[model samples]
Target: MTEIETIESFERHLRSGASLRGVVLQGLDLRGYTRELASVVLAGSVFLGCQLEQESVQAALAQGAMVFPPFLGLPYLPYRSGLYSTEELYAGFDPSRPESYADTLDARIYAHWSAQGRAHPVSIVEALAQRLHDHAITDAMEELLAGGGKHRKVVAIMGGHSMLRGQPDYRGVAVLARELTRHGFFMASGGGPGAMEATHVGAWFARRGEAELDAALAILARAPSYKDREWLSRAFEVRAAFPLSAEDRPACASLGIPTFHYGHEPPNAFATHVAKYFANSVREEGLITIAKAGIVYSPGSAGTIQEIFQDACQNHYNTVGVVSPMIFLGREFWTRTRPIYPLLEQLAQGQEYARFLRITDSLEEIVQALEEYDRFHTLSTIPR
Candidate 1:
C-alpha cells in the first residue's frame, strides 16, 4: 500500500473521493499557483496560511477566485479558522463578563467589519475568509444535491436581530419554523439573534414540538431579550432540557449557519448544521436570492419590511418560480400597523403583475397556502 505525493496525483485523489479538510500551502511561491490550485481544488480545502502574491493574487482574483493575504494589517496577527484556540478565541472574549460580551465582542466585531468598508485585505482576512468560503461552497454543494437549481426550496425568515431566545415572538417564530420544517422545508435568515434564532430553534424542535413547544418557550422565557442578563445561558438550558432520545435523534434536519460578522447576536446553537459566514453582504445577498419558497413576513420591524419588498420584486418577476408564496402571518400587523398586505394585494391585482398572494393570521393557513400553491404549481407544470 502506498500514497501519492505529487500534485497531479493529488487531483486524482480528490476526484477519486479521498477527502481533505485543510491543506498547507504556506511559503510556496505561487509560480506554480495553477498546479497548487489544482491541488486546492482536489483537496476541497480552504486556503490557510497560503501564499499568493505578485501576479498570483491578481491572477486568482481575475479568475474569480479569492486572493487575500493572511491577516493583512490586522490589529491582531495570524487570523485562524472559525477554528480559534480557547485562549485565541477568548483572547478577544471575556466570558466572566457576559454583559460586556455583547459590547466588546459582539458589537465590536460588526463595527470592525463595517469600518473595513468591505475592502478585501488578504492579510487580515485570508484564513478566516478561506474557512468561511470553503464552508459555504461545501454546503451549497450539498444543497444543490438536495434541491438543485431554481427549485427554490429554501425559505428565509428575517426579523429584528435583537429578538432574545425566549419571548412570545421568539416562541411564535420557532413554532412556525417547526411547522415549516415538518412540511419538509429548509430555513435561513440573517443568522443572528431574535427571529432568526427562533427560526433555527423551531426547526431544531421540529420533531419534538409534537409533544413540546410550550416547555421550550418556558425555557426561553427566562431570557426574553437578546441583551438579557442570561440570554445564552437560558438557550443552552433549553437545549439541555431536550436530551435527545435514540429514537428521537434522527428527526427533521436543522442546518443553520449563523455568522460572526454580527457576532453580537449569537448564532442559534439549535441549527444542527450551521453554514455561518463572515461576509454579511455576501450572506445577505445570497440569502435573498436562494430562497425560492418565498419569505414570510412576521411582525418584525424595518428589516423585515425591507425583506418584504425585496421578496416582492423577486416574486413579481417570478424570479423564483412565481414567487412561491409571500405569506404574511399577522393580519393586524400587515393589515393595520404597517399595512403592507392591502398594498401587495393591489399590486398583484395589477393586470401587468400576475401574482399569487395569501395574507392570514392562522399559522396552519400560512403553511397550507404554501403547500397548496406548490401543489397547484406542480399540477400546472404537467401537460393537461
Candidate 2:
C-alpha cells in the first residue's frame, strides 16, 4: 500500500487536481463541491467512514475507491485524526442536570458498543481498523506533547481503575500523581477510574496546593466509585467548583490512553487529554512505551500484573534506547498476595538492569528512584 494521506476538506483535494491517489477522506462533506469530482483519479484511495451523497458514492465506487460508512457502533466518525473532548463525548448532557446520563453522547457510544455483545471488540477486521485509528491518534498525541517540550519526560502510574474514590490508596495515588506533575513530569495512566483518575487529578491540580487537592478529593468522595449513581456527576461537580484557570493550567502536560474495548469503565475526566482507542492491547502497549521517565505500580489485579511483566520486558531488553525505572508502590500487596516482585528481583540479579528496579511502599522512595535514574542518565539536550 502507498503512504496514506488524510484529506478532510474537499477544497484541499481540489487543489491537488487529478493527482489524488492513496488519499483517505475522513468524514469530509464533498456534496455539491463540484459535479466533476467523479472525474478525478481515486484509485488506491479510501473514503474512510465518510458520509456521501448517492452520486458521490457511486462515482467513488466506479473510480475504484473503497467506501466504508461510519462505524455503526460508534457515535463519532472512527476515521477522524484527533482525541475526544469531554464536550464531544457528553454533547447532549446538561451540567445543570448531571443525574441523567442516558442521553449523553458518551453513554450512547458506550451503549452502542455494549449492545454488540462485547465490552471491547475481538473481531479481526474491526480490530485492524481500530488499530489504524489508534496509531493515528498516537501520532497526533505525540506531536502535541513534543510541541510542548515534554517528549520523553512523560511518566506513568499503573493500577486498577477499580480503586474507590474515598479510599486511602486512592488518596495516595492522587497525592503522588500531583507531586510528580509538580516535579515537571507529564503524568499518564490507563485513563480509567480509580488510580488512573487520581493520576489525572494530580496533574490537574499540579499548580495548586495540597489544600486544594484535599478539597477536590473531598468533593469526589461523595460518589466513591464509577458504579455509583452520581459518580460522573460528582466529578463534574468538583471540576466546576474548583475550576482551573487558563493561566495556571498547562493543558497538555498529562495524558490518558484509555481503550474503549473496556467501555464499561469510563475515562476519567481529570486527564488533561485522552488518546482513547478501540484496541486495548495497543492502548496498553502505547501507554507503557511513552512513559520514558518511569512507571509506578500501585495495587492492582490481573491487568496490572500484565503491565508489570510487559514493562519489565521493555526494560529487560533495553527497549526505547535506555531502561526506565519501575517502582512498586505497595510492598505488602506486591510482595505477599502477588509475589511477582521477588521473581523480578531474582531475574535482575547480577545484571545492570537491577539498577532500574525498585520495590517500595514509600512514595518518597519512588520519587528518589526516578531522580536517581535521571541523574545517572543525564542528557546534554532535551529528550524528544
lDDT of each: 0.60, 0.77
Tens-digit lDDT track of model 2 for 169-224: 99999888878877777888998999999888888887778888899999899989
Instruction: Write down the TM-score of every candidate.
Output: 0.68, 0.82
Looking at candidate 1, what is the lDDT of residue 266? 65
Off by over 4 Å in 2: 1-25, 35-47, 50-74, 94-99, 119-132, 148-152, 378-384
Per-prediction CA RMSD (Å): 7.4, 4.0
lDDT by residue for model 1 over 278-300, one digit each (tens)? 65555555566776666777778
**Cα miss at 373, model 2 (Å)?**
2.3
Model 2 scores what on Cα lDDT? 0.77
**Residue 379 error, candidate 2, Å:** 2.3
